[model samples]
Target: MNAILRGVRVIDPLGRLDAPGQDVWIDGGKILAIYHHIDAAGVPVVDLTPPDGVDPCVLCPGFIDLHVHLRQPGDDEAETLETGARAAAAGGFTHMVAMANTTPPIDTPERVAEARLAASNLPVSILQVAALTRGLDGEELVDIRKCVESGAVALGDDGRNSVSPRQLAIALAETAHLSRAVFVHPEDEEMIAQANGTQGSVTRSPIRPVETETRAVNLAVRALSHARSGHLHLQHLSSEGSVASLRRARHQGLAVSAEVTPHHLSMWLPVAEEPDPQALRKVNPPLRGELDRVALVQALREGLIEAVATDHAPHRAAEKSLAYDDAAPGMIGLETALATCITIGGMGGEWLATLVERLTVGPHRILGPASGVPEPRLRIGESATCTLFDPNAEWTVGETPLHSRSRNTPLIGARLRGTVLLTLAGGRVIHQDPARVPIVSEQVTSV
Candidate 1:
């Protein structure tokens, strides 16, 4: 739909549209024009300006998540492409990279193509991350060249840290030639198994240990040291030791980047101690100590962690209802990551606009040369790939589905300050809140 977004704060780093009270014209999947205007003929107008006493909103580059699992072609009961896409749009994401740890595991060209087809119709642009090793067995590398050419944005071996350092070094060396990225699920298997459902030794079942993540981070750093090409991306970093390692690596001039999940920014350890119903807290790396959470937040602020990825893992309620250690790990985050980051991560309005950049440009950098969406110019003739939200609008977590098939988020009853109002991908209205607290438009009606 052709529309004019009026008087909204356009917080774009590219166009220097950080100034508020501007107008944006979107048509034909591109930004037709951007200017200061009160009216335009023959087009609909979206008054992003708040009504009297309502908080103001802003338009920004739609969020780009570097890591997420859509659980399609396999775990539809957990989540499907449709629900995942809706969830992403609802979360203000227009582009996201889907992890390859699926039912059959997106390993081959054919599997990547099939995953692409499944995501093709979604409102969000979903890129597949083909398995780094065959079946994610971590024993042998998949066709790294073929996977990238076949539509995989990047390659990874997530869901477990069972990969051999020698094999992974071989994989990284091979991936260097492809000039893509390798996202490792940062953890050491032996150390974690040794933790045995408890970090401090009063063990019940096997759980992840902080040393496991630190060891994996060190190993990944060493492996990347052997590679002269390709990027090394760390996924869902969970500890202060992990952050310290990545930070030092960046200082040493390595082509490495890391991500922190929303949950890590919010929740602390003693995850296994939580009740079974909320057992989704049982993540692979597991939540860390309070010091770890503080360090992670500091890393985000200091730009040590390059992006905030949802790690948007979804699982069946029944699966999560199982015993804590026996339950599936990961809660849905595409819907709650932003709010969690804003509130739980302690990013208020002072850091608000910058967070949008971390969600958009930061992840864009993580995607690197493989992204299909051109970098934004925040000007006329650019693709109208952006998101809109009311920064001051308050709502309870359960007010909207955010379109996820799963209801596994831990923030269900928590109240949040900001709300995503609309999400546009290529000038099309992909998602909007029907029960949006009414906005007072000047001349045209709101969508």
Candidate 2:
């Protein structure tokens, strides 16, 4: 349905528009025109103008998450593609990359097609990340060309980066012509095993030490130097050395881009020191200390780290209720990602434009400039995909019900600002929070 967003502040970083009091007209799944005023007699009208018209709600291109775990085709109890898509829309993401570490990993062309079928008609665009290896076993690369043909957006060995550097280089060289990237979860298996081996007992400190990630990053970067053409997209980088290695790689002109998770930026590892297990925070490539988080923020500010991706892994409550050592390593993230970044990581309105760009354009760049996904812009003929948010809106984390099937987030009781009010994909209002948004009217009136 066509809807005219009346008196909304448009934040279009690519178009270089930070204009207030604009009327954005959407029809036929595209932005028809953006004017100073529009009479909304033919369609519905969403009045975003605050009563006083000061510090009003903002409109930007629909958010995009480059990395997410939907757990479809394998674990529906954790999250289905439909539920994950709704959760993404509720979080203001119109598009997200679904990680392929499922029951049967998305490694073959047939599996990729199956995932596409599962994601059919979802609220969010499900761009499947095909596993680098046949089963994410770190050996035997998947048919990159075939998988892409079957609708795979990118390639990765999610949660498994201990693949032999030789094999990774070979796979990269083979798929170089495809122009699709291999997103790596940089973690050394030997280091983790060693960290646990040293502590024979079930209880262990630094299960996955800092060195595990840094060493893997170092190896991946070094190996990337030999790859033919394709870029190496690193996922969920948390350690200080990992950031430094990425920085050095960029300076050296290696085709590499990396993303940092919200949990890594805000929360630290409580499992190591706490007398009681903090199973909720237990994640793969485990969270580090304040020093690591400080460096991550510094790197992000310096433009060394280009994107912030919520490695939105969803696990069942029963699974999360187990002992720290036995409990699952991930929790739901899509619903609370923006607030977590804003409140916990201190990324507020001043950085809104940059934050929007990372979620929209930066992730798109990893797929390639010529990738078919439309650039998020506020121009006539552009797809009318937008996300409306109230930066100052306050709400408790868990109190606001998430759209996801699982409620495994750690930010249950934390109060947060920056709430998503509306999300439109292809001009369709896929998700709208009725509580926070103003009433839509048949007649439009300027504030």
Candidate 3:
């Protein structure tokens, strides 16, 4: 694992480092040193220096995805822990929070422990969250204490929205004692049900309107205020109203954090008609109007919304191939997240570092101080987990050769402006774009 990344730009927000043309030395499993020049006489090297006309690749703290769906313990055909980890590494995520909404759901202490063990060996750390309600049925609460004790990073019922703010408040009250956060899918289920009608598709109908999310956010914020304990994390906020609610909640001194998804930020509803209409773009809290999309981007830039999660839900092709109203609501994003954000998010200059911070430090905030997830920084003695990406590299999304088992994303055939060139997790080379980086081996001497 000893190597030096040469001529790369380093961006570590927590460490207050944003420098270019630095050589980062990695030894064992931690960063050894960083300088303008490191003697490569005796160590393996990865040439991060781009060829003429190309921008130098960026090296930043290992990206953390706050929301991901590893359809394991049930739907393996769509995604397994191993497959999902592969996709994550490919996308430059050193850590990801796996939602607890599987077949049977990870609602018990035993299941949470099992999920951790199942992912223990993956290159990226999979922090599994426990279901807020048993079976995600929203009827009964799970053993929140035992689940957290068994190593669940947070509590959530993502696939199933919270039944009521009261239910969420009770769950928050329980997690408050544990010093953990409750990740709530802030969409009013009753409103969605009534709006979509029984058996109606969310995308086909008027959809889960902005009110569905804003109302839930307001109620959840009030619930958190009443509980007066525990951190409340709103997941995949897609509307201006939701962002405003979060701002108000934070202004009131509530321990609240929120995440936005790549799809919601880049894409919008009233999807353009293709030769053949497809359900690939359908998602819960379905993409709002263009104004909402613009608001999300601005919120992210201003740090009002803290994290950018992929909500990397993977479903079988058959599940996604259904009619617009009947198809599953999710898109595989671990592989496309970074590039999509850079391109569609309009990230550049100072905002680039801000985007990287959201991907790294922001998720850690939602995990809470008690989760034991390391602060993502590159420094002497810090773990050598980081990502190197070519921000100006243009690549089009293809229909085949995807790392994820699912191909439910609407970005197929769309050209993206950025791509990850290398991803290192704990000094391990989990992913590398070989053509761009040439690995050299030798014995290292003093610089």
Candidate 4:
């Protein structure tokens, strides 16, 4: 793990650093130094200097995913802790907040400890979230204090809503005292069912309507406002209504935050002329109209949305190949999140820097110290947990080999511009694109 990254552009948004042609020295799992040149005696070097015509690779604090589904102690045919960690590392993420809505549901202290132990040796750090309610049934609350004491970073019932705004308020109030966040799915199933039962009051499409997201956002925000405590993080926010609600909540200082998925920000409904039997693009808080997509991008730009999580729910091919309504409601995004934001969301310059901040700084701020994780930075003495990526590397999705076990991304056939070149977690080389940034004796010329 001890090596030199030569001529890499360092961009730590939190540190206000954006300097190119810098050499970062890593020794003993800590950043030894970062300067124009580092003359080390025994440590090897990896030349990160781009070719004459290519843009230099960018290095930044390791990415943190606020929300991801690593189905362990459950659905192993789709994704395990090993595969999910690999995918997160491949996507340049050093830390991932794994959701609690698993097979048995991470609702107890023992389960939380088990999950933490499972990911202890993985490349990426897994911050386990305890379910807000037992079995995620939304009927009874889980023991919040015990779970947090057992290493649960946050509390959430992500796969389903909290049943009612009042119930969510109660949970939030409890978590507020604990200094932990309650990540809500923010989709009102009751409202959707009612809307479907009625006519003309709501969109009667077979697919879930935008009103579902909007109403749920309003309810969740109201719950936060009522609780007047705890951080309420809305997951996978879609629709312009949700944006307006988030704007008002933040304006009123409600201590609530929200995240948007890559697919929701990039794609829209009815992408194909015919029905998709495999339901590749189908996701809970499903994709909306093009207008919704545009609004989501603008919301993230305006800081209404704090993070861009993968919601990396993986499923087996058989589960994904079921009928549209019966298929799973997520896509594997750990390997494609950054590229999607850059290419599909069209982020660049200051905006691109802002996006990186969301991936690193914003999540850390929301999770706070209770998450039991340190903030990643590329500075002297900081842990050498960082990512290197080529923003101009264009390649198709499915054409490349993904580390994840599942392949449910809608962008499978599309071209993406950015690609991760290397990833370091705890000073260990977790993932490196061998063909692009191989470390060999010939390439390691000392200064």
Candidate 5:
């Protein structure tokens, strides 16, 4: 089967193509051709004439989250692979990396295989990251080669930082030998004593200081120096000083990349002062001051921040209802990431294009398929992965409209501008507006 996506603009940052009024053709799960017009008669076409009252929209490569916890095989009450992938598709995401912090921890080949099999049934792509140590205890290293062969993309102890520098060095060395990257959660546990919110004068709560992140980064960089084969990727960096340290490491020619979440870029810790703890403003690497927020935005604009990931960790209502110290450390982000990027991050069309590239191609280079810009017009002969969004459409978020099983999002009631009109993965329209006719799945394939 062949499908045509017509009358939509194409946006690819690396290719410098941000043009409108083109048609895309996908055949057998690969983009065959993209042009202003397709003359073939047998192929089915989906005419996407921009509604008269609505502004023009843009079509780009689907997003890929570098850090996510699907919580399958354990902790299903919070989220599962099937439900999480649905949430990812609703947010215009085509792929996501599942963190290694599962119930038993993804530390063995069998566990990695189980996760991949479970995720294979979903519409989107799910890549598992194996544990850096057995059971994530930071004691003994897992079988790096076997885990990678069993479908693990990388190795990491996502929830907890390794305790000993020697243990970390050994793991990095093994990963380097296997030609894989090691994703580090960059936090010095010693500094994490009862730290809840951001460390600043605006809040009376004692929060984890900036040194926690810097110390972990410095240690990871030094370990990389000894084991130079693998790259070090940092997750959810919040402080300005941490960014500076990463920039300096990159300047010195170390292989390093870092990601920032939307909550950190758009909100600050002052919101925690609200009387209602249920407001869902508090998060890990807790929201910083206005200064830190501005710095993070600047880093994104200046290329210091390589990617913007959701860290889409979901928790249940009961889990988030507890006191500040007792509540879980995450908020639902996959559903609202792009909207937050466009509305709050002040990203224009070009910047938005760059962000999409960072979310898809950039991360893909680090983990999965080789990096390359999605061709213009979204035609056939290319992988059938695309995201269609209304850039100027306005919508208010609420609990009833959210697709995630968990309703712990912080963006509820917030007026957002961009909206995902349709999302396709492997030539299948996993999510489409009910008002529009759905596209049939042409052909499906996965890595």
Candidate 6:
């Protein structure tokens, strides 16, 4: 399987170079050669000739999602490993970390092994986050070593906050000894009771104050202090104050990193109308105020937010239609993430490259196994994991066209700039523009 992606603009965040009119050759799922010029007679090539009169599209490393819910073995109605991987590949993501909140939670090493087996055939890499507690109950700690041995990338109780500080400390201590990171949801139960939406009078729902997140983070940080350089990752940080707390912790030499979601950066409370419970916009660590949104965007530009994750939680429409309090929190995000980064974040080519690195290399460093690393100008002998994007292209998101099993995206009907033209994983085009030519199914294979 030798093919040349010629005449494409290559953006390598690691190399910090954006060179246009280059050729990339991929063979056996690894890049064979990349250069500005290649003789046609020397080797087989496929002209990825740019569209007439249009500049070549950007070719960058595939994205890595730090947080996503691929409800497998339980709630397949919402999403499964296979479907979620397909959606991720189409969205230009080559790897994703699956959360630990599914039914029969990924608490044991056996369960983690099960997930890996289930996802073995997917085109997108699926990394499992083992539960921080047995059954994610926050009472009993799971076997950290066994879970890690079973293929869990990290440990977390994503959907629920660890209720017992003592238990959390023990878990952190054990994970630290094992050289594994712990991801905390960072929500104090008492504060979370009143804090559901942005804190302000504009929204009817009670605001989940900044204190809720900061307080929980403080606890986690304190717990980590007892351990041996335990890496603590704060998930879905939504407040300016939360970011400030993490910043100070890092300045003080704490092993802390954080991620922010697109919705938190893109939307604010106090809409003309209150968000419908069924809108899928209702999410945990609910959307914050405009000021927070602005601060988060600034943090991204300033490199305070280490990664941008979709927190791609999905639920059936019927499930989301419940009352505001009863409806589940989360929305489908894999597909809309890149578009939102371009459209709402007001980021262009260079920043987009950085974001892709953050999604790929940054998370990979934290989780290890080292999948994402900067490449040298798309040279030969490189891994064949790449994303082709049309930055200037525009498209409207609709429920009917989304690949997620759930149609729970708030961006539906929203006009978005930028579209993924093709995604190649292991020298195979898992997704391609159907309008251009019907991609043979034989060319597609699971990751």
> Among these predicted structures, which one has the highest TM-score?
3
Which of 1 and 5 is the better model by TM-score? Answer: 1
lDDT for each residue of candidate 6 in 230-320, tens digit (9 for 90 to 100): 7888899888888888888888898888888878878722221344554467787887788888888778777777788989998888878
| Predictions in order: lDDT | 0.77, 0.77, 0.82, 0.81, 0.74, 0.76
lDDT of 2 by residue, 1-447 (tens): 477878878888888888878888777667887888888677777777777735667788888888898888788998888788888988989889898889888889999998888786776788888898887877688888899888888889887765788888887776677778888998887777777776322222337878888998988887788775668888898888898899899999889999888788777233113322367777877877888898987777666777888999888888777778777777678877787777676466577667777777777777775346778776688666888887778887667577788887666667777788878787667777666544432211110
In candidate 5, what residue range of length 10 has the lowest lDDT sum?
A: 368-377
Could you give candidate 1's per-residue lDDT for residues 244-361 as a string of tens digits? 8998888889989998888888773222134337675666667777898999888887778878899898888887788776677778889887878877775656777778777887
The sequence of per-residue lDDT tens digits that candidate 3 reaches over residues 1-447 is: 677888988998998999989898877767888899998679977777777866677899889998999999899999989889888988999899999988869999999999999988888889999998987877899999999999999999886774567887888988988988999888877788787775532323436778888988888899898887879999998898888888898889999998899888888222223413367777877877778888888989888889999999998989877777777888889998888888876555457888899999988877878998888888788667888898888887763377888877887777777788777787677887767755622221101
Worst 10 residues of 3 by lDDT: 438-447
Top-down lDDT ranking: 3, 4, 2, 1, 6, 5
Q: What value does the lDDT take at residue 171 in candidate 4?
A: 82
Best model number under lDDT: 3
Which window of ten consecutive residues has the lowest lDDT sum in model 4? 438-447
Clashing pairs in 6: 31-381, 32-380, 33-380, 122-446, 122-447, 123-447, 195-207, 195-208
lDDT of 5: 0.74
- Number of clashing residue pairs, candidate 2: 0
Using TM-score as the yardstick, the better of models 3 and 6 is: 3
* Per-residue lDDT of model 4, residues 12-47, tens digit only: 987889888999887766788889998788878888
- Candidate 2 error regions (>4 Å): 27-29, 39-45, 50-54, 198-206, 268-277, 369-371, 436-447
Candidate rank order under TM-score: 3, 4, 2, 1, 6, 5
Give TM per candidate: 0.90, 0.90, 0.93, 0.91, 0.87, 0.88
Candidate 2 — worst ten consecutive residues by lDDT sum? 438-447
